[model samples]
Target: MAAVFATINNIAKPGCPTHCGINTVSYPFGIGRECSLDNSYSLTCNTSYEPPKLFPISSDDFEVYNISDSEVRVATLVSYRCYNQRGALGGIIKGFDLNLNKEYTFSVKNKFTVIGCDDYTLIGGADESYVSGGCFALCRKEQEVPNGECSGIGCCQASIPKGLRSYDLTLHTLLNHSDVLSFNECGYGFLVEEGSFKFGGAADLSTNYSEFVTRLESTVPIVLDWVIAPNKSCAIGVNICKGNSSCYDVEGGGYHCKCNNGYEGNPYLDPGCQG
Candidate 1:
Protein backbone atom coordinates (compact mmCIF):
# COMPACT_ATOMS: atom_id res chain seq x y z
CA MET A 1 0.00 0.00 0.00
CA ALA A 2 1.15 3.52 -0.80
CA ALA A 3 1.22 6.24 1.81
CA VAL A 4 -1.47 8.91 1.38
CA PHE A 5 -0.64 12.29 2.87
CA ALA A 6 -3.48 13.28 5.18
CA THR A 7 -4.80 16.75 4.40
CA ILE A 8 -8.17 18.33 5.22
CA ASN A 9 -7.38 19.71 8.65
CA ASN A 10 -9.17 19.01 11.89
CA ILE A 11 -12.74 18.16 11.09
CA ALA A 12 -12.73 16.69 14.57
CA LYS A 13 -11.42 18.46 17.69
CA PRO A 14 -7.83 19.73 17.80
CA GLY A 15 -6.36 17.21 20.24
CA CYS A 16 -8.18 14.13 18.96
CA PRO A 17 -6.42 11.61 16.70
CA THR A 18 -7.68 11.71 13.13
CA HIS A 19 -7.06 8.18 11.91
CA CYS A 20 -7.42 4.48 12.64
CA GLY A 21 -4.48 3.20 10.59
CA ILE A 22 -5.26 4.31 6.99
CA ASN A 23 -8.85 5.24 7.78
CA THR A 24 -9.38 8.91 8.65
CA VAL A 25 -11.68 10.09 11.44
CA SER A 26 -13.46 13.40 10.92
CA TYR A 27 -16.17 15.55 12.44
CA PRO A 28 -19.52 13.83 12.90
CA PHE A 29 -17.33 10.73 13.17
CA GLY A 30 -15.00 9.97 16.08
CA ILE A 31 -13.36 6.97 17.70
CA GLY A 32 -14.76 8.01 21.09
CA ARG A 33 -16.75 10.69 22.89
CA GLU A 34 -14.27 13.58 22.77
CA CYS A 35 -14.59 14.20 19.02
CA SER A 36 -17.83 12.56 17.92
CA LEU A 37 -20.45 14.85 16.46
CA ASP A 38 -23.22 12.77 17.98
CA ASN A 39 -24.08 9.26 19.16
CA SER A 40 -24.58 8.13 15.57
CA TYR A 41 -20.96 8.81 14.63
CA SER A 42 -19.08 7.11 17.47
CA LEU A 43 -16.63 4.38 16.45
CA THR A 44 -14.64 1.70 18.30
CA CYS A 45 -11.24 0.30 17.42
CA ASN A 46 -10.18 -3.18 18.54
CA THR A 47 -6.43 -3.09 19.01
CA SER A 48 -6.36 -6.76 19.94
CA TYR A 49 -6.89 -7.60 16.32
CA GLU A 50 -3.58 -7.77 14.43
CA PRO A 51 -4.33 -5.06 11.87
CA PRO A 52 -6.82 -3.34 14.17
CA LYS A 53 -10.50 -3.39 13.39
CA LEU A 54 -13.02 -0.56 13.30
CA PHE A 55 -16.65 -0.82 14.32
CA PRO A 56 -19.47 1.60 13.75
CA ILE A 57 -22.37 2.55 16.03
CA SER A 58 -24.10 -0.60 14.73
CA SER A 59 -21.43 -2.86 16.13
CA ASP A 60 -23.30 -6.15 15.99
CA ASP A 61 -24.59 -5.66 12.47
CA PHE A 62 -21.51 -5.30 10.29
CA GLU A 63 -17.77 -4.64 10.36
CA VAL A 64 -16.56 -1.24 9.21
CA TYR A 65 -14.22 -1.66 6.25
CA ASN A 66 -13.46 1.90 5.13
CA ILE A 67 -14.76 5.45 5.41
CA SER A 68 -14.51 8.48 3.10
CA ASP A 69 -15.77 12.03 3.32
CA SER A 70 -19.26 11.15 2.08
CA GLU A 71 -19.25 7.36 2.16
CA VAL A 72 -18.54 4.42 4.45
CA ARG A 73 -18.12 0.81 3.33
CA VAL A 74 -18.89 -2.13 5.59
CA ALA A 75 -18.36 -5.88 5.28
CA THR A 76 -21.22 -8.34 5.53
CA LEU A 77 -21.58 -12.08 4.92
CA VAL A 78 -22.38 -13.53 1.52
CA SER A 79 -25.66 -15.30 0.86
CA TYR A 80 -24.60 -18.68 -0.49
CA ARG A 81 -26.23 -22.05 -1.00
CA CYS A 82 -24.65 -25.46 -1.50
CA TYR A 83 -26.56 -28.49 -2.61
CA ASN A 84 -25.70 -32.16 -2.81
CA GLN A 85 -25.87 -34.15 -6.06
CA ARG A 86 -29.43 -34.86 -5.04
CA GLY A 87 -30.30 -31.14 -4.70
CA ALA A 88 -30.51 -31.09 -0.89
CA LEU A 89 -29.54 -27.99 1.06
CA GLY A 90 -27.75 -28.18 4.40
CA GLY A 91 -28.14 -24.51 5.42
CA ILE A 92 -30.43 -21.50 5.67
CA ILE A 93 -30.69 -18.23 3.73
CA LYS A 94 -28.19 -15.38 4.26
CA GLY A 95 -28.39 -11.55 3.99
CA PHE A 96 -28.61 -8.34 6.10
CA ASP A 97 -30.93 -5.67 7.51
CA LEU A 98 -29.75 -2.08 7.10
CA ASN A 99 -31.74 0.84 8.47
CA LEU A 100 -29.39 3.76 8.33
CA ASN A 101 -29.66 7.20 9.93
CA LYS A 102 -30.25 10.43 8.04
CA GLU A 103 -26.53 11.09 7.75
CA TYR A 104 -26.09 8.32 5.19
CA THR A 105 -28.05 7.03 2.24
CA PHE A 106 -27.38 4.16 -0.15
CA SER A 107 -25.81 5.28 -3.41
CA VAL A 108 -27.78 4.46 -6.55
CA LYS A 109 -24.62 3.11 -8.19
CA ASN A 110 -24.76 -0.37 -6.62
CA LYS A 111 -26.12 -3.53 -8.20
CA PHE A 112 -27.66 -6.65 -6.68
CA THR A 113 -26.06 -9.72 -8.28
CA VAL A 114 -26.73 -13.46 -8.26
CA ILE A 115 -24.47 -16.16 -9.64
CA GLY A 116 -25.25 -19.77 -10.46
CA CYS A 117 -26.74 -22.01 -13.12
CA ASP A 118 -29.98 -21.98 -11.21
CA ASP A 119 -30.49 -18.88 -9.11
CA TYR A 120 -33.38 -16.63 -8.11
CA THR A 121 -32.61 -13.89 -5.61
CA LEU A 122 -34.87 -11.25 -4.07
CA ILE A 123 -33.60 -8.15 -2.32
CA GLY A 124 -36.05 -5.92 -0.53
CA GLY A 125 -36.35 -3.74 2.55
CA ALA A 126 -38.41 -3.49 5.76
CA ASP A 127 -40.87 -6.36 5.66
CA GLU A 128 -41.02 -6.17 1.86
CA SER A 129 -42.86 -2.84 1.94
CA TYR A 130 -39.95 -1.49 -0.16
CA VAL A 131 -37.41 -3.34 -2.31
CA SER A 132 -34.05 -2.68 -3.85
CA GLY A 133 -34.28 -5.27 -6.63
CA GLY A 134 -33.84 -8.96 -7.56
CA CYS A 135 -32.67 -11.33 -10.34
CA PHE A 136 -33.39 -14.79 -11.83
CA ALA A 137 -30.81 -16.75 -13.79
CA LEU A 138 -31.21 -20.12 -15.44
CA CYS A 139 -28.49 -21.46 -17.68
CA ARG A 140 -29.59 -24.80 -19.18
CA LYS A 141 -25.98 -25.55 -20.06
CA GLU A 142 -23.05 -23.72 -18.54
CA GLN A 143 -21.41 -23.49 -21.97
CA GLU A 144 -24.41 -21.57 -23.30
CA VAL A 145 -23.49 -18.60 -21.10
CA PRO A 146 -20.26 -16.74 -21.68
CA ASN A 147 -18.01 -15.88 -18.80
CA GLY A 148 -18.04 -12.31 -17.40
CA GLU A 149 -21.40 -11.57 -18.94
CA CYS A 150 -24.20 -10.76 -16.51
CA SER A 151 -26.88 -11.11 -19.18
CA GLY A 152 -29.21 -13.27 -17.09
CA ILE A 153 -27.32 -16.39 -17.99
CA GLY A 154 -25.19 -17.82 -15.22
CA CYS A 155 -25.12 -14.35 -13.64
CA CYS A 156 -27.74 -11.62 -13.26
CA GLN A 157 -27.86 -8.08 -11.87
CA ALA A 158 -30.37 -5.36 -10.98
CA SER A 159 -30.33 -1.71 -9.98
CA ILE A 160 -30.80 -0.50 -6.40
CA PRO A 161 -33.04 2.26 -5.11
CA LYS A 162 -31.60 5.72 -4.42
CA GLY A 163 -31.34 6.98 -0.83
CA LEU A 164 -32.45 3.55 0.33
CA ARG A 165 -31.97 3.13 4.07
CA SER A 166 -33.22 -0.42 4.71
CA TYR A 167 -32.30 -3.62 2.84
CA ASP A 168 -32.76 -7.42 3.04
CA LEU A 169 -32.26 -10.42 0.72
CA THR A 170 -33.60 -13.95 0.13
CA LEU A 171 -32.63 -16.80 -2.19
CA HIS A 172 -34.67 -19.17 -4.32
CA THR A 173 -33.90 -21.76 -6.98
CA LEU A 174 -35.51 -23.56 -9.88
CA LEU A 175 -35.49 -27.40 -10.30
CA ASN A 176 -33.69 -27.34 -6.94
CA HIS A 177 -30.54 -27.93 -8.94
CA SER A 178 -31.78 -31.39 -10.01
CA ASP A 179 -31.06 -30.02 -13.45
CA VAL A 180 -27.68 -28.53 -14.41
CA LEU A 181 -26.23 -30.09 -11.27
CA SER A 182 -23.19 -31.48 -13.00
CA PHE A 183 -20.70 -28.62 -12.59
CA ASN A 184 -23.14 -26.11 -11.10
CA GLU A 185 -24.77 -27.28 -7.90
CA CYS A 186 -24.52 -24.22 -5.64
CA GLY A 187 -25.45 -20.56 -5.87
CA TYR A 188 -24.18 -17.17 -4.59
CA GLY A 189 -25.61 -13.67 -4.41
CA PHE A 190 -24.53 -10.24 -3.19
CA LEU A 191 -24.89 -6.46 -3.51
CA VAL A 192 -21.76 -4.74 -4.78
CA GLU A 193 -20.46 -1.30 -5.57
CA GLU A 194 -20.86 -0.81 -9.31
CA GLY A 195 -17.82 -1.11 -11.62
CA SER A 196 -15.56 -2.38 -8.84
CA PHE A 197 -16.13 -6.00 -9.91
CA LYS A 198 -17.41 -8.05 -12.75
CA PHE A 199 -18.82 -11.56 -13.18
CA GLY A 200 -16.43 -14.50 -12.97
CA GLY A 201 -15.29 -17.15 -15.43
CA ALA A 202 -16.76 -20.54 -16.37
CA ALA A 203 -15.18 -22.17 -13.33
CA ASP A 204 -17.15 -19.78 -11.16
CA LEU A 205 -20.36 -21.47 -12.25
CA SER A 206 -19.30 -24.81 -10.79
CA THR A 207 -20.46 -26.72 -7.72
CA ASN A 208 -17.10 -26.10 -6.00
CA TYR A 209 -17.40 -22.35 -6.39
CA SER A 210 -18.88 -22.04 -2.89
CA GLU A 211 -15.63 -23.17 -1.31
CA PHE A 212 -13.62 -21.06 -3.71
CA VAL A 213 -15.50 -17.95 -2.66
CA THR A 214 -14.54 -18.52 0.95
CA ARG A 215 -10.98 -17.86 -0.11
CA LEU A 216 -12.01 -14.47 -1.45
CA GLU A 217 -13.91 -11.43 -0.18
CA SER A 218 -17.50 -12.41 0.49
CA THR A 219 -18.89 -8.86 0.62
CA VAL A 220 -18.26 -6.09 -1.90
CA PRO A 221 -17.60 -2.36 -1.59
CA ILE A 222 -20.56 0.03 -1.61
CA VAL A 223 -21.05 3.80 -1.71
CA LEU A 224 -23.06 5.90 0.71
CA ASP A 225 -24.07 9.54 0.28
CA TRP A 226 -23.89 11.77 3.35
CA VAL A 227 -24.46 15.44 4.11
CA ILE A 228 -24.55 18.03 6.85
CA ALA A 229 -27.81 18.73 8.62
CA PRO A 230 -30.07 21.76 8.10
CA ASN A 231 -31.29 22.39 11.63
CA LYS A 232 -27.68 23.10 12.62
CA SER A 233 -27.20 26.75 13.53
CA CYS A 234 -23.63 28.10 13.55
CA ALA A 235 -24.87 31.42 14.97
CA ILE A 236 -25.74 29.96 18.38
CA GLY A 237 -22.68 27.68 18.31
CA VAL A 238 -24.63 24.47 17.72
CA ASN A 239 -22.46 24.27 14.59
CA ILE A 240 -18.92 25.61 14.51
CA CYS A 241 -16.78 27.13 11.73
CA LYS A 242 -13.40 28.43 12.78
CA GLY A 243 -11.32 31.45 11.71
CA ASN A 244 -11.44 32.74 8.12
CA SER A 245 -14.20 30.21 7.41
CA SER A 246 -17.81 30.24 6.32
CA CYS A 247 -20.56 27.61 6.61
CA TYR A 248 -22.83 26.45 3.83
CA ASP A 249 -26.07 24.56 4.43
CA VAL A 250 -26.77 21.73 2.01
CA GLU A 251 -29.68 19.45 1.21
CA GLY A 252 -28.39 16.51 3.22
CA GLY A 253 -27.14 15.77 6.73
CA GLY A 254 -24.85 18.55 8.07
CA TYR A 255 -23.58 21.98 7.17
CA HIS A 256 -20.33 22.27 5.21
CA CYS A 257 -17.41 24.58 5.96
CA LYS A 258 -15.02 26.27 3.55
CA CYS A 259 -11.83 28.22 4.13
CA ASN A 260 -11.67 31.86 2.98
CA ASN A 261 -9.91 33.05 -0.25
CA GLY A 262 -6.42 33.24 1.26
CA TYR A 263 -6.45 29.89 3.11
CA GLU A 264 -7.37 26.20 3.00
CA GLY A 265 -6.98 23.63 5.77
CA ASN A 266 -10.35 22.41 7.03
CA PRO A 267 -12.46 25.34 8.13
CA TYR A 268 -14.09 23.40 10.94
CA LEU A 269 -10.85 23.43 12.92
CA ASP A 270 -9.38 26.14 15.15
CA PRO A 271 -6.67 28.35 13.58
CA GLY A 272 -8.31 27.19 10.36
CA CYS A 273 -7.28 28.18 6.80
CA GLN A 274 -3.75 29.46 7.28
CA GLY A 275 -2.04 30.79 4.13
Candidate 2:
Protein backbone atom coordinates (compact mmCIF):
# COMPACT_ATOMS: atom_id res chain seq x y z
CA MET A 1 0.00 0.00 0.00
CA ALA A 2 1.27 3.43 -0.89
CA ALA A 3 1.12 6.04 1.88
CA VAL A 4 0.37 9.71 1.22
CA PHE A 5 2.26 12.27 3.26
CA ALA A 6 1.28 15.86 2.60
CA THR A 7 3.77 18.68 2.94
CA ILE A 8 2.33 21.38 5.20
CA ASN A 9 3.81 24.20 7.24
CA ASN A 10 2.12 25.99 10.13
CA ILE A 11 -0.81 23.65 9.77
CA ALA A 12 -1.29 22.81 13.43
CA LYS A 13 -2.43 25.08 16.25
CA PRO A 14 0.22 26.57 18.49
CA GLY A 15 1.87 24.07 20.92
CA CYS A 16 -0.07 21.14 19.47
CA PRO A 17 1.31 17.93 17.98
CA THR A 18 1.48 17.87 14.20
CA HIS A 19 1.80 14.14 13.47
CA CYS A 20 0.06 11.06 14.84
CA GLY A 21 2.33 8.15 13.91
CA ILE A 22 2.63 8.69 10.15
CA ASN A 23 -0.65 10.59 9.75
CA THR A 24 -0.71 14.37 9.84
CA VAL A 25 -2.90 16.24 12.42
CA SER A 26 -3.39 19.58 10.79
CA TYR A 27 -5.43 22.53 12.07
CA PRO A 28 -9.24 22.18 12.27
CA PHE A 29 -8.43 18.51 13.05
CA GLY A 30 -6.43 17.76 16.18
CA ILE A 31 -5.75 15.14 18.82
CA GLY A 32 -7.02 17.10 21.81
CA ARG A 33 -9.64 19.62 22.88
CA GLU A 34 -7.83 22.92 22.64
CA CYS A 35 -5.73 21.59 19.80
CA SER A 36 -8.62 21.54 17.37
CA LEU A 37 -11.24 24.02 16.31
CA ASP A 38 -13.90 22.05 18.18
CA ASN A 39 -14.81 18.67 19.60
CA SER A 40 -16.18 17.39 16.30
CA TYR A 41 -12.72 17.85 14.81
CA SER A 42 -10.88 16.08 17.63
CA LEU A 43 -9.00 12.80 17.03
CA THR A 44 -7.65 10.05 19.15
CA CYS A 45 -4.09 8.71 19.10
CA ASN A 46 -3.78 5.21 20.52
CA THR A 47 -0.18 4.27 21.26
CA SER A 48 -0.90 0.58 21.98
CA TYR A 49 -0.74 -0.29 18.29
CA GLU A 50 3.04 -0.50 17.67
CA PRO A 51 3.42 2.58 15.47
CA PRO A 52 0.27 3.92 17.16
CA LYS A 53 -3.15 4.44 15.60
CA LEU A 54 -5.26 7.54 14.96
CA PHE A 55 -9.04 7.70 14.79
CA PRO A 56 -11.72 10.34 14.64
CA ILE A 57 -13.28 11.14 18.00
CA SER A 58 -16.70 10.38 16.57
CA SER A 59 -15.78 7.02 14.99
CA ASP A 60 -13.26 4.82 16.74
CA ASP A 61 -13.82 2.02 14.21
CA PHE A 62 -12.23 4.04 11.41
CA GLU A 63 -8.54 4.64 11.69
CA VAL A 64 -7.17 7.85 10.24
CA TYR A 65 -5.24 7.10 7.03
CA ASN A 66 -4.00 10.48 5.85
CA ILE A 67 -4.82 14.20 5.98
CA SER A 68 -4.28 17.08 3.57
CA ASP A 69 -5.32 20.72 3.51
CA SER A 70 -8.89 20.05 2.36
CA GLU A 71 -9.32 16.31 2.68
CA VAL A 72 -8.93 13.44 5.14
CA ARG A 73 -8.74 9.72 4.36
CA VAL A 74 -9.72 6.88 6.67
CA ALA A 75 -9.61 3.10 6.55
CA THR A 76 -12.91 1.37 5.66
CA LEU A 77 -14.39 -2.12 5.73
CA VAL A 78 -15.40 -4.41 2.86
CA SER A 79 -18.82 -6.09 2.89
CA TYR A 80 -18.70 -9.71 1.79
CA ARG A 81 -20.77 -12.85 1.36
CA CYS A 82 -19.19 -16.29 1.68
CA TYR A 83 -20.55 -19.68 0.76
CA ASN A 84 -19.51 -23.32 1.14
CA GLN A 85 -20.05 -26.02 -1.46
CA ARG A 86 -23.33 -27.08 0.11
CA GLY A 87 -24.84 -23.71 1.07
CA ALA A 88 -24.26 -20.27 2.53
CA LEU A 89 -21.52 -20.09 5.16
CA GLY A 90 -21.45 -16.58 6.59
CA GLY A 91 -20.53 -13.00 5.75
CA ILE A 92 -20.68 -9.38 6.80
CA ILE A 93 -22.77 -6.53 5.43
CA LYS A 94 -20.53 -3.60 6.21
CA GLY A 95 -22.21 -0.33 7.13
CA PHE A 96 -20.96 3.04 8.30
CA ASP A 97 -22.64 6.08 9.85
CA LEU A 98 -20.21 8.94 9.93
CA ASN A 99 -22.32 11.31 12.09
CA LEU A 100 -20.10 14.04 10.78
CA ASN A 101 -20.63 17.66 11.77
CA LYS A 102 -21.80 20.18 9.21
CA GLU A 103 -18.17 21.10 8.63
CA TYR A 104 -17.41 17.85 6.84
CA THR A 105 -18.83 15.70 4.08
CA PHE A 106 -18.00 12.56 2.10
CA SER A 107 -16.39 13.46 -1.19
CA VAL A 108 -17.89 12.47 -4.55
CA LYS A 109 -14.65 10.85 -5.64
CA ASN A 110 -15.67 7.57 -4.00
CA LYS A 111 -17.27 4.70 -5.91
CA PHE A 112 -19.57 1.99 -4.64
CA THR A 113 -17.78 -1.11 -5.93
CA VAL A 114 -18.72 -4.77 -6.04
CA ILE A 115 -16.74 -7.83 -7.13
CA GLY A 116 -17.97 -11.37 -7.71
CA CYS A 117 -19.27 -13.81 -10.28
CA ASP A 118 -22.90 -13.20 -9.29
CA ASP A 119 -23.31 -10.37 -6.85
CA TYR A 120 -24.85 -6.93 -6.53
CA THR A 121 -24.72 -4.40 -3.73
CA LEU A 122 -27.03 -1.53 -2.80
CA ILE A 123 -25.88 1.55 -0.90
CA GLY A 124 -28.35 3.67 1.06
CA GLY A 125 -27.57 7.02 2.59
CA ALA A 126 -28.45 8.11 6.11
CA ASP A 127 -31.59 9.92 5.09
CA GLU A 128 -34.36 8.93 2.70
CA SER A 129 -34.04 12.28 0.93
CA TYR A 130 -30.49 11.43 -0.16
CA VAL A 131 -29.98 9.41 -3.33
CA SER A 132 -28.58 5.86 -3.38
CA GLY A 133 -26.20 3.99 -5.70
CA GLY A 134 -25.91 0.31 -6.57
CA CYS A 135 -23.40 -1.97 -8.31
CA PHE A 136 -24.12 -5.27 -9.99
CA ALA A 137 -21.28 -7.68 -10.86
CA LEU A 138 -22.00 -10.85 -12.74
CA CYS A 139 -20.02 -13.31 -14.85
CA ARG A 140 -20.69 -16.77 -16.25
CA LYS A 141 -17.14 -18.07 -15.72
CA GLU A 142 -13.81 -16.99 -14.34
CA GLN A 143 -12.40 -16.70 -17.87
CA GLU A 144 -14.97 -14.04 -18.75
CA VAL A 145 -13.87 -11.75 -15.90
CA PRO A 146 -11.48 -9.05 -17.03
CA ASN A 147 -8.49 -7.92 -15.01
CA GLY A 148 -8.58 -4.36 -13.66
CA GLU A 149 -12.01 -3.93 -15.20
CA CYS A 150 -15.17 -2.96 -13.31
CA SER A 151 -17.76 -2.73 -16.06
CA GLY A 152 -20.47 -5.16 -14.88
CA ILE A 153 -18.59 -8.32 -15.78
CA GLY A 154 -17.00 -9.87 -12.68
CA CYS A 155 -16.68 -6.39 -11.17
CA CYS A 156 -18.80 -3.26 -11.27
CA GLN A 157 -18.78 0.23 -9.75
CA ALA A 158 -21.24 3.08 -9.14
CA SER A 159 -20.60 6.69 -8.24
CA ILE A 160 -21.55 7.92 -4.78
CA PRO A 161 -23.40 11.20 -4.15
CA LYS A 162 -21.45 14.44 -3.93
CA GLY A 163 -22.30 15.40 -0.34
CA LEU A 164 -23.07 12.04 1.20
CA ARG A 165 -22.23 12.10 4.90
CA SER A 166 -23.18 8.55 5.87
CA TYR A 167 -24.19 5.32 4.14
CA ASP A 168 -24.77 1.58 4.67
CA LEU A 169 -24.40 -1.28 2.24
CA THR A 170 -26.39 -4.50 1.56
CA LEU A 171 -24.97 -7.24 -0.68
CA HIS A 172 -27.25 -9.49 -2.78
CA THR A 173 -26.36 -12.34 -5.06
CA LEU A 174 -27.99 -13.76 -8.17
CA LEU A 175 -27.13 -17.42 -7.47
CA ASN A 176 -25.41 -17.17 -4.11
CA HIS A 177 -22.17 -18.29 -5.74
CA SER A 178 -23.72 -21.77 -6.23
CA ASP A 179 -22.94 -21.75 -9.94
CA VAL A 180 -19.50 -20.18 -9.60
CA LEU A 181 -18.27 -21.95 -6.46
CA SER A 182 -15.50 -23.79 -8.23
CA PHE A 183 -13.36 -20.70 -8.72
CA ASN A 184 -15.15 -17.94 -6.85
CA GLU A 185 -16.65 -18.62 -3.42
CA CYS A 186 -17.28 -15.13 -2.14
CA GLY A 187 -18.68 -11.76 -3.13
CA TYR A 188 -17.26 -8.42 -2.01
CA GLY A 189 -18.46 -4.83 -1.94
CA PHE A 190 -17.06 -1.57 -0.66
CA LEU A 191 -16.86 2.21 -1.02
CA VAL A 192 -13.45 3.26 -2.21
CA GLU A 193 -11.76 6.34 -3.60
CA GLU A 194 -12.20 6.43 -7.36
CA GLY A 195 -9.07 5.57 -9.39
CA SER A 196 -7.38 4.45 -6.19
CA PHE A 197 -8.02 0.74 -6.79
CA LYS A 198 -8.48 -1.70 -9.64
CA PHE A 199 -10.13 -5.11 -9.54
CA GLY A 200 -7.77 -8.13 -9.73
CA GLY A 201 -10.56 -10.23 -11.30
CA ALA A 202 -10.59 -13.92 -10.33
CA ALA A 203 -7.62 -13.61 -7.98
CA ASP A 204 -9.63 -11.24 -5.78
CA LEU A 205 -12.49 -13.70 -5.27
CA SER A 206 -10.22 -16.22 -3.52
CA THR A 207 -11.38 -18.26 -0.53
CA ASN A 208 -8.57 -16.85 1.59
CA TYR A 209 -10.82 -14.11 2.93
CA SER A 210 -8.53 -12.82 5.66
CA GLU A 211 -5.55 -12.09 3.41
CA PHE A 212 -7.76 -10.54 0.74
CA VAL A 213 -9.51 -8.26 3.22
CA THR A 214 -6.28 -7.11 4.84
CA ARG A 215 -4.77 -6.24 1.48
CA LEU A 216 -7.82 -4.26 0.41
CA GLU A 217 -8.12 -2.24 3.62
CA SER A 218 -4.46 -1.28 3.50
CA THR A 219 -4.65 -0.11 -0.09
CA VAL A 220 -8.04 1.61 -0.20
CA PRO A 221 -9.56 4.30 2.03
CA ILE A 222 -12.61 6.57 2.15
CA VAL A 223 -12.05 10.21 1.35
CA LEU A 224 -13.78 13.13 3.16
CA ASP A 225 -13.83 16.83 2.38
CA TRP A 226 -13.56 19.36 5.21
CA VAL A 227 -14.47 23.02 5.32
CA ILE A 228 -14.92 25.92 7.71
CA ALA A 229 -18.29 27.55 8.61
CA PRO A 230 -20.32 25.14 6.54
CA ASN A 231 -23.52 26.39 4.83
CA LYS A 232 -22.20 29.93 5.06
CA SER A 233 -20.40 31.61 2.20
CA CYS A 234 -17.45 33.98 2.53
CA ALA A 235 -19.85 36.89 2.26
CA ILE A 236 -21.63 35.97 5.48
CA GLY A 237 -19.19 33.86 7.49
CA VAL A 238 -16.45 35.22 9.68
CA ASN A 239 -13.34 35.72 7.63
CA ILE A 240 -10.50 33.36 8.49
CA CYS A 241 -8.31 34.11 5.52
CA LYS A 242 -4.96 35.66 6.23
CA GLY A 243 -2.88 38.05 4.17
CA ASN A 244 -2.39 37.25 0.47
CA SER A 245 -5.14 34.63 0.67
CA SER A 246 -8.50 34.38 -1.07
CA CYS A 247 -11.74 32.78 0.07
CA TYR A 248 -13.93 30.69 -2.16
CA ASP A 249 -17.20 28.86 -1.60
CA VAL A 250 -17.19 25.09 -2.10
CA GLU A 251 -19.90 23.46 -4.18
CA GLY A 252 -21.60 21.61 -1.31
CA GLY A 253 -22.09 24.62 0.98
CA GLY A 254 -18.92 25.73 2.72
CA TYR A 255 -16.00 28.03 2.28
CA HIS A 256 -12.23 27.44 1.98
CA CYS A 257 -9.21 29.67 1.95
CA LYS A 258 -6.46 29.43 -0.62
CA CYS A 259 -3.18 31.20 -1.13
CA ASN A 260 -3.30 33.66 -4.01
CA ASN A 261 -1.75 32.93 -7.40
CA GLY A 262 2.08 32.72 -7.57
CA TYR A 263 2.25 32.32 -3.76
CA GLU A 264 2.57 29.12 -1.74
CA GLY A 265 1.73 28.85 1.97
CA ASN A 266 -0.99 27.94 4.42
CA PRO A 267 -3.86 30.34 3.74
CA TYR A 268 -5.16 30.13 7.29
CA LEU A 269 -1.88 31.07 8.92
CA ASP A 270 -0.82 34.49 10.17
CA PRO A 271 1.91 35.07 7.59
CA GLY A 272 -0.39 33.54 4.95
CA CYS A 273 1.19 33.21 1.48
CA GLN A 274 4.90 33.64 1.08
CA GLY A 275 6.51 35.39 -1.87
TM-score (C-alpha) between model 2 and the true structure: 0.89
Candidate 2 stretches with Cα past 4 Å from truth are 89-99, 262-265, 269-275
- Rate residue 203 of model 2 by lDDT: 86
Worst 10 residues of 1 by lDDT: 1-10
Worst 10 residues of 2 by lDDT: 90-99
Per-residue lDDT of 1-275 in model 1, one digit per residue for the tens? Answer: 12132344445676776777666677657788667777677887767766666677556455566665556776534677767777887464455566776666677777777888788988877732376467997788867978778888888888987657677666788877878788787778876777765677567777365464553343456566665563454444434777887776645335566777888676655676678
Each model's RMSD to truth, in Å? 3.6, 2.3
TM-score of each: 0.81, 0.89
Per-residue alpha-carbon lDDT of candidate 2 for residues 178-201, written as tens digits (9 for 90 to 100): 888888887888878898888888
The candidate scoring highest on TM-score is: 2
Count residue pairs with overlapping backbones in model 2: 0
